[model samples]
Target: MLVSFRLPLLNEEMDINDAAGIQALLEQLRSSQAWQEAVALPTAPNEPNIVPEPEESNSAPSASVAELLSQLRTEPDTSTLDRPSEPTPSLPKPTTPATPHLTPLTPTAPTADLSDLSRHLTFQQALPVIANLSGNPNLIQTLKSVRVLLTCLLELMFPSQMKDEQHALETRLMEERKAIVTKYEEKVKVAKTKASMIGSGMSKHEASMLSGAFHKELKSFDTERVLTAWDGLVSQQQDALSQLGIPIMFASTEPSHRESQQKVIQVLEGLL
Candidate 1:
């Protein structure tokens, strides 16, 4: 036996495999106004529905607005607002007067006298006197003649007294000589004591070497010879005075007289 079966279909249902039918149905729904209104899509939540209002005609402001604007346009009382509560007192500044500048005057040097220079005075002290007398030849000659006369008179009147004064000067010179010798000898003794103390801490050879050098220095330290040399110089000066016929005793007498004699002697020697 052969049997055939047919599937049942609904009147409102469409076949899922029928593309043409579905497209035609969509076109019909789009064309129908009633269908479009009935099934309209909802607006998006982010999109606002704004309606523009109509513009009003040009006119003046209201009475209250006009009064408010007039009040704003009026000027404020700045004088009262800017003023301080109390007025401040101002003090005057003190001024200092300028002092006058003064120029100082130069001082003049004092004049020196020829009679003030002496043999007891140093070469430095006699320099001014010598300079003053240098130009006056007649005055110098007169001084020399006076000194010669005075010296002759002194020698004739007090020969014994002059000799005693000369002896005293020699004695003083000898005492100075002894003092110098004693000073140098004390220095040598001190050097020897220092060397001995230092040598205690040194090698024998080094100590001996130092001792030799120290003794050699002492040998060359002849203070006695220096005194003798000074004595020779004094002797030479005395011999020169004797040759010139001027007494050494005259130098120890009146300072003014000795000064004049010295000045005359210096002039004569310079001429020679």
Candidate 2:
């Protein structure tokens, strides 16, 4: 840069041949630099010039977030400005109806005759009666067995025609059975007594008599006779039941009804 000034000075200020002129040019350059050090200079043309903004002004500056919030709090809302206010809809109230008076109904009795003899009875109808008569589920099975034997007997003999003869025969048989049992007990006791007496030194005749009487009494209570009598009475009752068309439940001879019959028999036994 000093060379640029030196070239112009060489061309116009002084003669390069004179040494006195060269010394004078250097002295002028130093003086100019010294004067510049004593005085302030403006910014260079290449640099930006900045000036401080004034703190106080008439026009408002852009607001900070805090200032904007406070301004909003102090100001009235403009969002709903010029808009009309609407009325809320009124809802209708519900109305309840008055309660009505009700009449109580009475139960009516059945019109059918329950005891009509001509009514055809099924097992369902008869079972209850049978259960009632038997009074025990076990007895139902025994009654069924007796009925079965009686039915077989009825196939070979004539049935009774007397009114309620079946019930009468049953009652008579039960009484006879009781009597037989009592008589058997008495016979057993007498036989035991007579044998005991014979060992206590009875005469030959008395001994023979006691032995003969004991054997005779023992033979008198014939099991087969008792059974035959019972069978006869049952046959007559069976005839009566057949005459009435009463069904014997679980009495089917078919193997298909076997399980049902067993179940019915069991149930009857329980009822009895």
lDDT of 1 by residue, 1-272 (tens): 11121112223456545677655644553354533333343444885533211122111212222332233332444677677657667676776767778878777655653222243455455455556655667544433333221232222211333344545655676675566566656755665677678784435675566567655544544344534443443344333343433332122335464455555455444642
Q: At residue 216, what lDDT does model 1 achieve?
A: 57
Q: Work out the TM-score per prediction.
A: 0.20, 0.22
Score each candidate by Cα lDDT: 0.44, 0.44
Candidate 1 local lDDT, residue 192: 68
Per-residue lDDT of model 2, residues 143-236, tens digit only: 4444233332222112323323444655676676567667656755676687678785435775566567655544563345445554465545
lDDT of 2 at 67: 30
* Total clashes in model 2, counting residue pairs 3 or more apart in sequence or in different chains: 8
Top candidate, metric TM-score: 2
